[model samples]
Target: MIEDDAAVRRGVVDALEYAGYRTLEAGDGDEGLRMALGASYRLLLLDLVMPGRDGFSILAELKKKRAGQPVIILSARGEEHDRVRGLELGADDYVMKPFSVRELLARVEAVLRRTCERAAPEDKRMIPGGEVDFSEGRIAFEDGVEEALSEREGELLRYLLEAKGRVVSRDEILRHVWGLDPAKTETRTLDMHIMHLRSKLRDKAQDFLVTVRGKGWRVVS
Candidate 1:
């Protein structure tokens, strides 16, 4: 959790702890940004308005470096723009301030549950001149070289492999991989990560991660 307000931060942390969830918190954006970038956590609870490096800025950085992270924004701003911008920046959910503890907890549970359900199964895939070991999170090439994958990249590849070569829409990718509703959010995060994954796999997006024109993407090979 990252909140500037002491009372709200304490209350939320207490509630989460009471509910059997362990949490790490920061009182300002700078600290939160450091923790967000370095720590290993299942979910992040962020405040939009902070002393420095606001949540939106933090979220943008996360999208670039940790796009698979699950995040929910807590903010006093209830304007359409605020909410829309958060979603566009790849936040999984947005909770307006003055929200009840009950409501907040419920949202937290829902997001976590959806994320858990999207967990990728263990498997390995054979690709051109190399093979991907999902369980090991690495690629073994014919030249005796290997490249490791980040957790997000592995999950993305796992999801694509699960599609069995069928075209999957961007909306479907968001729903299954990011656990966000495609209709409610606008983001190119999915496309960016897909491109990154292709580069890691040493395959062109058009060849391996096929663009289905008006649809989404498919792993053809």
Candidate 2:
């Protein structure tokens, strides 16, 4: 939990603990950013407006470094633009300030559900000329090339591989991979990530990650 307001932070942490969840609290943005990037927490609760390294900056850094980390933004700014910005910046959900404990917990549970479900499996997968080791976040090609997979890339590839050649919709990807509501979120983000993933996978012919026109994406393997 990261909030500049001590009272709000304390209440949220207490409520989360009461609900049988372990909690870590950061009273300012700097501490929040440090702990958020370094800690082993499953989820982050962030306040948007804070002194010294605002939540938006922290969120951007987190996305770049730990794209798979689940985050929910909490703020007094309830404007549509604010909410949209949060989601676009890779927040799994956004909760307005003065929120009830029940509502906050519900949102937390929903986000966590999506997160736990999409986590990469422990095993590695052998592809045509390469192997993807999920546990180590590394991909090795047959000709002695190896590359590290970012957390998001690893999870995306894992999901596509699990689809077993079936078309997985952009909406499904948004929900499963991003933990965001597909109906409310834009699909363009999904496409951009797909492009990045293909480049990383070295899909020269686009043979592996196939796009089904007017539908979704599929893994040819």
Candidate 3:
């Protein structure tokens, strides 16, 4: 946990400890960032407004170095933009200030559960027109054509294939694959990536990757 308010931080830490959780805490942004980057923890509780290094900076660094890190933002900034910004910076959830202990604990539990449920990524998968070798970042089509995949494209395809049977919401893809906030309106990038993936896979008919209107994308067998 990283919080500047001493009383608030102590209260939260005490509550978490009482609930059978061991915690490491910091009262300022610089120390918090250091601990956050170095400490081994299942989840991170971060304060957006802090002295020295703010939560946004720390979040950006984590996104670059530890894309899979689970983080929840705690802030008194209740504006929609603040929440959206935190999420866009790769926070898993946002908890506003003056929040209840119960609510905070519930958010923590939910984030931890979601993180734990993510399966290990696969290095290769068989697609419709070819086999995607994620390790090599390339696709081998049946007609003997080969296409290279950018790192982002490879990760996106791998995520979709992992959740093959169901429609994955755009927000979920953004959070899990791009580390972007799902609530952000700029999803054109995601759409473009999907289009590129489809082209690379030779899925012009959309038989392999199907977009469910008002929902998300799904990979069909």
Candidate 4:
């Protein structure tokens, strides 16, 4: 958990640990960013209102380097823009302030469970060259360099590939991946993610990705 406020940070971290998760704490977003990059964790609980390198900025930078990571933003401001911005920055979910421990725990478990569910073993994947090897929690390019996938990115790519040429509505992806419905205009977040996968799939470009535009996307091998 990375939060500038001592009370919220302590409360959240303690609750998380009590719920059976091993967590690391950071006083500011900068420290959180460092811990996130250097180590892989199942989830990140971030505070959008933080001192020195706010949550949104940290989220953006972390995504530039590791797009697959799962982040849950916690904020007192609960404005529509705050929620939208966090989701647009690739956050997996967001929790408004004065939330209950039950709600927090539920989101954490739900996010991790969803990630685990989509993570298929490479051996079981039927892709031509190879699968992303999601079960291993890394982006295994057929080229041999195994890049670590942030939890969300791996699951997003997996879901897209599994759509298998069928047009998947943006809302579906949003609801399924983020475990919540962001504003309708926030659908482009899905497009942004697709673009990221396309860039990552450098060599696998012609394999299974086909864009439908206006309507939705399909993966045609």
Candidate 5:
């Protein structure tokens, strides 16, 4: 858990340990971000306001690098916008400051359970002009050319194809495919990935992957 307040951190850590959960603590955001990015943990408990590097910034980076990581925001900022922002940024749950230990633990358990129950996407799918083998991480075109797809590319295509015949919002794509909070500024990353996928799929005319203006994207069925 990454929290700046020492007394609160200590109390939470103690409570968690007593409940049979292992704990790691960081007093500041810089150290917290490093550990969050490098460490292997099931869930993260984060604080919003902190000295040097705030929780939101750290959360943004974490989502970009470790999209599937589950996070819960612990903050005194109980405003509606703050909660909405946290959720948009991919926080699985938000616990307000001055919360009960029991409630916090319950939230942790629920998030972990939900995360564990999520199923992995299918390993292979056939696109319009080619076949995408996610397990092989490559696209085999009908014309005998194969193009490699990065992990992110494969995920993007998989999500789009899964939602074929309907427009999938950019926010949905970011949250599901990129494991990011859609509220974070700018979707250039999503746009870039879409561009790359189009090129790799040889959809120069956008016949397979089409963009819906003011909405998101759809894989033509």
Candidate 6:
């Protein structure tokens, strides 16, 4: 996860973990880039502005140093040129600040899903327990059991799995999963749902949720 605001960082990181993902976090573009390169993660969540390197420079370095990795820019750079420039500089996608969680998850999911299927075609999706088929939305666990998920859980899980390796943001989650318009409501509601999801899935596979300090959730390897 990459973000500057301290408050945003905490909320986002918690949400990402509760949602079942592993994450790496950075406060600015330079740190984001360093973490991105130093790690062998499947996804990169980047911020454009920073104390030193800035997002644009980071993107350039990411492309130059780690050509195969995919990048998603999360920043205040909502201007048209900024978006285009990010893409041109090898950023796979861009998300402006004050973004919607629904949109963020959707974009993150689309990028990771697409990339995995393209590069690791043979083992792209995880078939947990021979009962839990992530892509299929059906689980075939013990007792030869199989079931469908509620609409919201399905969406949340989908997004988590897609990134699978980085903390997702809270604003991103609320906007994306609940489609909640920005409001004054407490964020605790998200925690309840995550607990429920965690309880249900833990028995079937390796621990999925990892709480990244001051960041969001990620679904990692």
Best by lDDT: 3
* Candidate 1 accuracy as TM-score: 0.61
Best by TM-score: 1
Local accuracy of candidate 6 as per-residue lDDT tens digits, 1-221: 77777777767667666667688788876677667656546788777776777878887876654554688888776889989999999988887777766677788789988777754322224434434455565545565666655657667766666665766766457755676643434568776766666655653343566666565677755
Write candidate 2's Cα lDDT for 1-221 as tens digits: 98999999999999999999999988888999988866667899999988788999999988755556799999999999989988999999999878999999999999999988866465689876899999898899999999888898888999889878978777567756888765466557677778887887898688989988887888997
Worst 10 residues of 4 by lDDT: 119-128
Cα lDDT of model 4 by residue, 128-171, tens digit: 45556677765555667655656787888777777666676565
lDDT of 5 by residue, 134-214 (tens): 999999988999999999998888877876477777766776667666555475988999999999988899988998889
- What's the count of clashing pairs in each model shown? 0, 0, 0, 3, 1, 21
Q: lDDT of model 5 at residue 73?
A: 97
Question: Which residue ranges in model 2 land beyond 4 Å of their true spot?
Answer: 119-126, 129-221
TM-scores for all candidates: the values are 0.61, 0.59, 0.57, 0.57, 0.59, 0.52
Judged by lDDT relative to the true structure, which candidate is superior, 3 or 5? 3
lDDT of 3 by residue, 22-64 (tens): 9999989899987886666789999988898999999998775
Candidate lDDT scores, in order, read 0.86, 0.85, 0.87, 0.74, 0.86, 0.68
Per-candidate alpha-carbon RMSD to the true structure: 10.5, 11.5, 10.5, 12.2, 7.8, 14.0
Return the lDDT, model 1, position 50. Answer: 83
Q: Which TM-score value belongs to model 3?
A: 0.57
Please give the lDDT score at residue 169 for candidate 5. 76
Q: What is the lDDT of residue 155 in candidate 6?
A: 71
